[model samples]
Target: MILYGGNVVKKAALWYILIICLRVSAKNGVTQDQVSSRTNTLFDDVDDTQKQLDNEVRERLAQPKTVWVIHIPTRFPVLQLEDLSVTEPTFINTALVRSRREYQLGNPELEDPIISNNTTPCENVEEESSSEEGNVCDSDRTESEKPSEPEKCEEQEEKPGDDWTFDTQHKWHENFPDCAGQSQSPVDLPIAGLIKTRGARKLLFVNYNEIPNNLTLIYNGRNVILTGNWPRDRTPAVYGGAAHSRRYLFHSLVVYWPSEHTIATLHYPMETQALHVSAEYGSFEEAVANSPKDPLAFLGVVNIYKFDSETQAGLRTIINSAQKCKKWSVSMKPMPLSVFSPPFKEYVCYQGSLPIPPCTESVLWMIRRRSLTVNRESSLAFHSMLLGDDPPQKVFIRVAQALNDRHIYFFR
Candidate 1:
């Protein structure tokens, strides 16, 4: 029996009905072979009838001065009617019937027909529509497919010399060979070694008594930096103890949290670095280029978060200023340099390199032994600010490097 269907759902339902009939016949004592034979015969009869119709259509289409019109339904509204012509009537008829069947079955492969010519057969119209639809469907499927495992891994892999982050420590040596050197910064300070050291000179701070009134809070990719608006001649300088008679000019200050390195098995909740360059160099870039060996000094101060209901006045100002500036943005405000400075002066001296990349060695590191107190409210505020806009990694701290026979001196 032949079934006529207008939609794909109907055709699918018809197929299910045929399968049910076959199962019923088998249950009614019909042999399996006989039931299979009957099913094949029914399909063969339908195929023959379809072939005959196609042949007849083809023969008629071959006649001269003949115009065939066909109707096609699409998901969208039928905008206009079109006439399509084909030389082989049988092929055109078969294609049209196949397309109509597939569309009714809810096949995503069917394309909308373009019916411009009223004289063309419906089969020809369907063939044109299917061609366009196939291209679009295939292209979309290809693009939407999930990427392979290897492709995802490649995207996540860190490359050498890319922006430095805490997780990218393995790639640091590849980018800057100096990172693997012996005198790298942030070395673990054993409490026994620091206390046992003798002949350590006291550190002297020059012009650090007054805080610079004009300063800006800049959110670099890694940390929040405080840049001062002090002239080259008027910039604060520090010497004494391990600072070998050479005055280090204070440049910028960076604030960090969750101490990058351990000291006497203790980890501070926050840390800050006051970066200074050699006074001999005119600019920071010049100092880095000319004195590649050891031209910078870092005064490190660690801080512990205390449970205080009120936030520190200086820290509250920084948090407020950061809220006005977007991530990775810099905004100038009337901030004081003393706000970010350490409260205590007693420190431990050591020789190390820049903790960050290009990892230049020969830096005089003066880490304060006493921990500064930051209010719990302000500490939470610091964590709220993001490092940069769309940063690859959210972590701001770098991993501590090896000590490699370096001595830690305590200067009171």
Candidate 2:
């Protein structure tokens, strides 16, 4: 029978009832009805093999896989440089010098004689220079001394995130290769954010939004100067749009580190006989160290490094090391489609860009086998931290866009 057909549960319940009644009739003195008569008429022609085939198809119908199609850009513009290395001028130097000039004019207190050429006369100098030659010295230098060109700062090139946007002509298709025509952004490059593959496993991506970006917290006594306001979009938050801010979900990533396995076993929840997160009777590392060698079951504790603004570049610089390792993997437990579904009850389908930029149209939308729970209290606490109470609470994430004709991959 088709798995989604109406009354399937009712039919299943009725069959159970019939079996119970048949047993009771046999125990009592009543002449029992034939098994076929009690349990809705059985098909004489359908054999065990045919029944098994139907069951297999029904199981397949219930779950589907998910795919992420990435798009790339074409024709990047060449950034102009003010200074170059190899004893040449480069763009970074030009930008830095310009930045220094603007900053000096904007903050008078920070202006130093070394930077401004001591042009701002001291009140005491006026008392001494009150004589004729002093007056001549001030007047002659006023016009003759060329305005000390704003002291040029040793220029450094601004990084990509601070100044670049993706090209517009390229677009993604639901299928492969078509999306491949569009080049991947620096962040989208498999090797850019994470390291390239080392041996056999895949490294997962992490976005640390909980840590604050305040410079004081990062640089307590450092000599380095920090620039630019940190972008809020990078932090997971409900941006106002088609989806209410409240609807968004937050996820964290962890690195995979494995240990030697000692036993062979099937993974399961102790009571339900289903796949669920296991409690660490011992520490998580101890569990991993002792558990059998199922690639999927190797769970261990990883130190979550705090990622704030000052530390971001240092981490990105070392990303290549993480990539050099043999294995890095992403978490792919099936999340409910309804959780990603739109707010309206009637609209069965729709589609849109990936919230992340280069917002490509490569999602093969599938909900979930089961809905994940988000209690009201937990959601509210999360939202209050991001949006603040200025506006009343609202659903935050975008509803699931349409699947189009794209094939969905279900991990069974």
Q: When superposed on Cα atoms, how far off is each prediction in RMSD? A: 38.2, 32.0
lDDT by residue (1-412, candidate 2, tens digit) is: 5666658887889999999998897765344334445442245336656989999999999878889886531111121212111221232243543334221211123223112222322211112111222112222344433122212223233434222111222332322222332222111101011111112111111122223242110110101121212234433222111121211222222111010110011110100000111222223233334333311121111111111112111111112112111122211112211111111111001122222233333211111111112223323333343233334433222222233432211111
Error of 2 at 330 (Å): 21
TM-score of each: 0.54, 0.18
Superposition error at 122 for model 1 (Å): 89
What's the TM for model 1?
Answer: 0.54
Give the CA lDDT, 0 to 100, for residue 404 in model 2.
Answer: 42
* Least well predicted 10-residue stretch by lDDT in candidate 2: 266-275
For candidate 2, give the lDDT of residue 380. Answer: 31
Candidate 1, poorest ten consecutive residues by summed lDDT: 146-155
**Clash count, predicted structure 2:** 40
